[model samples]
Target chain A: MNQTIETMLNHRSVRKFKEENLSPEQIQMIVEAAQMASTSSFIQAYSIIGVTDPEKKKKLAKLAGGQDYVSESGHFFVFCADLYRHSLIGKWENADVDDSIMSMEKFMVSVIDASLAAQNAAVAAESMGLGICYIGGLRNNLPEVSELLETPEHVIPLFGLTVGVPDQKTAVKPRMPFQSIYHENSYRHQKDTVKQEMNEYNEAISAYYHERTAGKRSDKWTEQMAKMLQRKSRMYMKEFVEGKNFAKK
Target chain B: MNQTIETMLNHRSVRKFKEENLSPEQIQMIVEAAQMASTSSFIQAYSIIGVTDPEKKKKLAKLAGGQDYVSESGHFFVFCADLYRHSLIGKWENADVDDSIMSMEKFMVSVIDASLAAQNAAVAAESMGLGICYIGGLRNNLPEVSELLETPEHVIPLFGLTVGVPDQKTAVKPRMPFQSIYHENSYRHQKDTVKQEMNEYNEAISAYYHERTAGKRSDKWTEQMAKMLQRKSRMYMKEFVEGKNFAKK
Candidate 1:
């Protein structure tokens, strides 16, 4: 009911943007808001790269599978799960911290830390009347992205956020029903109930697509998920993350 | 700054809480706000388990290394990186989605999805004059926790969010300087420059602790990090996640 909840509920990803850039003050405020998010055990293991140069943004757009919004956004921020600072601290204090840094626990912490911060940034941008899109397409080619970002060891480019003035309005996509995703105390694994919920959701999604595309396309949620998941994506992610000296324990 | 940004910026982990329960309306609104967060490629691969049973919460507290707040909060929600529903969809649609579900890319997507939603829930709770603390200690015994929750394969509980009324006030912890974590175009890996920034932050943190604890604790940020990382914690996380049918490429 409050403005904060309203902003969150009205969220949508904007792919089309106007040609105006965000003010430096807005950028600073957004990043500051991100910095205020909770960090696991005070290990603020994340960094943000603000891509302002037109040439760099263009290359990034190409890297993100030709998503032009990456180049034309008011600002593009690549959120990286970074532990290079912790590594330096280990060396400074003459402590043997390689095992911890390379452990899967630390990797998960860094990923969660980066994600929590990015959500705060998104909410901050939206609160300021700007639109933002999360660029998971960056993961389509992680090695190239890492090299382009010049990230050092133990620093992985997790995802990007493209923020700009919206040139096109988007409807908020429907999510899974509360009963489908929410459980009380313990997880309920009733297959019949789950199937019933999925059936209803599939119908809802079919109607949504039908209305959105003027009957040209009407795909159920499960149909879309099934089609997309039939093909493997980013299969090298495991090896790549391991090569970066993370989750190696 | 607007109300949403203010809610985000004022976030602090609330471990001590008043013995009060969240109303059904508050819980619904919080979860609805969470459902509105952006999902990667429309894969809403996440689930939330709300623990209202005192016995279950007590067991969870024990599982989280005796973090009593896990049991004392007004409401506790466990965010799980879930691909179980997608797997079910694959079966219903007769699609061979095993390879994709088992890939690291989908695993990362699930984790990111859950984290984003949890952060939104946190913001929503804070905006409503509530408090939240992320319980990462659940990772200490994930297998037992999973068994307790009765979650199926491909559903990994990432973390817990404890929401309640704050019983204690905590100061906002100082973070690393903006220059320390923000890069312009490319990631700045200047060792000397980073060292200088770390030195200044260490001084600030030392002073903060000195003032907060009345000289009882005056540890620098780097010192605390080095000491913490020197200990090998949660070494079994890699094998645990793999055993739970995730991140297995």
Candidate 2:
């Protein structure tokens, strides 16, 4: 128990990787751990596409805003929110899949299922002295990723995971103060929590970034938020997902 | 390492409790583990509301389809996909939060972040001999869960989690043959994977259900899928979330 909690606490994203790949047994074990994660309604609404082919990895890296780790990692996988198989099962049972599968709630459930499983996979990898980084950049060119991966409708690529031997270490990024996130029996207004700690957190974040980047970047949390929240990214995700039959046809 | 792996593999959702509440220290440790989880772009886009109030728990159990377990656990929490803090930070920085925070991609990021943190918390709890069940039924009536919890705009409840000592054990549910979910190199069509194992899986599920229910229910996986996929549930989620200011004003 102590070891597992320690592993979860000591986690850091590894973007650089050694050339070595994971053994088949390691991949198998990590995947089984992922499978054991609870799915909503036992729907098991997710799929994983492991990409070891160099050509395909290169294609994904380029499509994912040129993240070199996507192509250079020990193993790369695209975790998809998949309802396609359930639809097939519905057909086998002569049921109207559109009625249940097309709602926003189900779509949200699928996202939770996929995300939870991916975290388990990550923890499993970390427990074995391996490192992993999530590649949300994959969303930058979702249409192309869909085309390249041969992903069918109702299975959208949510994010990519790069699992590898760590070639570089990253600082454990500073999180906001505890009170800012942990609420009591009822939700407290921001003034009573996050606002109280905002400046302290901002300074801590600034210091962490300053040391990590050798003083090249020393922006606080709010400064980073300003820049990140100004750009409208993946604006077409709704239409893309809905078009892929995630919505009523 | 092996012990942690085994704990993850042996996971089951325990709905019944032993009438024991966790110590304050244990809950603190679990929440810290959750804070240590990786968030996209360091956004940390999630909030957890711990609900120990009997009235709130009873109200939630009713709103969440009368799952008595919601009100009968050692600890119950509603996890929210929070962009509220980011908007506040944007206001502090004088940036236009509406353009970036309102997009579907950002919404998806928040969902992934919140779900990942919740999974970590679940694992942390399980490592300490506590059993956890995810309460997705919270979405059944989002507005009420929000109202009961006093969750404000830009903060939406995604799911709930119940943690307690296990008083009952459920059968380890069988998953689809892994080839149905895991693909090599790229996505494989259902005809090439899931169909090959569908009938076998259906029979296994039927038998399992028969044994568990003493033949009171002998339905195949296909029959279950038929019933599960015919009802549209929580269709109001999109509008509810958008109303919470997660969408552009």
Candidate 3:
């Protein structure tokens, strides 16, 4: 396999990072790589905020459910789904129209754009031998994050990224078998593989935990996933979008 | 910069394509790479449906606002924001605890997960000398597309991708000046550079279009964006997300 493909296939999210700093030149190059990512309809509806201040980083870490890496990583950025620029652009020269910019689809384009750019930066950092992690906890307290970032209307803090040299090593956790998620024609229109494939995956993952933790913490994938992850979190996303004037009503 | 970074920076959305099919090995490697992408909290909340039927492809092409490449690429896949597996996991295990699976945050997690996986597939495809185009137009007629795919509730058809050999070559269009979107501390907390940078970008993009199209079209970034793209499209996204039983209420 080629270098690019190899880097992508061997992906990992690193939480513990060494104490080091990225050079300005290196950060510039990474940001340039992010800019090169394709934006939807060329809207370029995203912005990256580099948090260099230790105090701010510390507070951000606390805000993101005390994810220490948010402060510990040598570099951190909050990717915002931004439509303020489009509004600003509308104010200039396009005075006669800007109604479509306020639609739900347009707002989603910004969110997707932010996600795409952040992923590109993640791949770029990993390829450069730097470790990285995404802090979804940024949304653990959404309004506070917006206040902290001082984002204007039409902008929302989608997520934060932490990048640094790795200070810990970890295994790449197994994913569901290829056939389970990637299907021919359609998963629904085709066959029901969930019961069968998931049963097998449960075995593999159960074994994985048993082997990894010496049988100390053996939790099945579905059981643990349902109990842990499928919780009622971020119910205010609707409010968050609406409060920010991104409701596209 | 390294080869991987170069590959990413050189990416282009290929709409035109050579009529060729990808070998099964190539497709497997690409999906493997997609599976390897990092998921939010390892939930892996996404599924990919490869649409190989010419009849289905034709219908999808029409559904996506008549985007010809949806059928022309000879290979197509739809990325679904899936929480169905999580719900099923809840059903089999934590029957009483399925409340959280329907949260808005969980839904956003799935959307972001799907996008991350799709972008990895795009990068992997580009790495192997293949071309890709993301059809957000898949959402142009979202509910119908879902019915056509037979996807159940809590599964939204997020977007579609087309992959094949490139039948056209295009220059990399210019992005906003790096400093405009890449802020040192914050865009709002710091200074507003949008006007200045956009002024320069407008000139750059105007020149790009002028040269590329040989004066057949000349539209500034903000002007064209305001004139053409700012129309209110996909206003039903709010209702669609709410209707999927994935609502965060």
Candidate 3 lDDT at A47 equals 95
lDDT of 1 by residue, B1-249 (tens): 799999887888899999999999999999999999989989999999999988889999999999999999899999999999898888999999998998878888999999999999999999999999999999989999999999999999999999999999998898888888899988988888888899999999999999999999989999999999999999999998888778889
Residues A20-117 of candidate 2: C-alpha lDDT, one tens digit per residue = 99998888888888888989988888999999889999999999898999999999978999988888877777788786787777788888999999
| Candidate 3 CAPRI category | medium
* Better TM-score candidate (1, 3): 1
**TM-score per candidate:** 0.99, 0.96, 0.95
Identify the superior model by lDDT, candidate 2 or candidate 3.
2
The candidate that wins on TM-score is 1
| Candidates' C-alpha lDDT | 0.92, 0.86, 0.81
| lDDT for A86 (candidate 3) | 79
Residue B17 of candidate 2: its Cα lDDT?
94
Give candidate 3's error at residue B180 in angstroms.
1.1
In model 3 chain A, which range of ten residues has the least summed lDDT? A186-195
Residue B221's lDDT within candidate 2 is: 69
- Model 2 lDDT tens row, B38-103: 899999999999988899899999988999988999999788999887888887788887867877
Interface RMSD of each: 0.8, 1.7, 2.2
Off by over 4 Å in 1: none
Relative to the real complex, the DockQ score for model 3 comes to 0.63
lDDT of 1 by residue, A141-179 (tens): 989888888999999999999999999989888998988
Docking class of 2: medium
Residue B115 CA error for candidate 2 (Å)?
A: 0.4
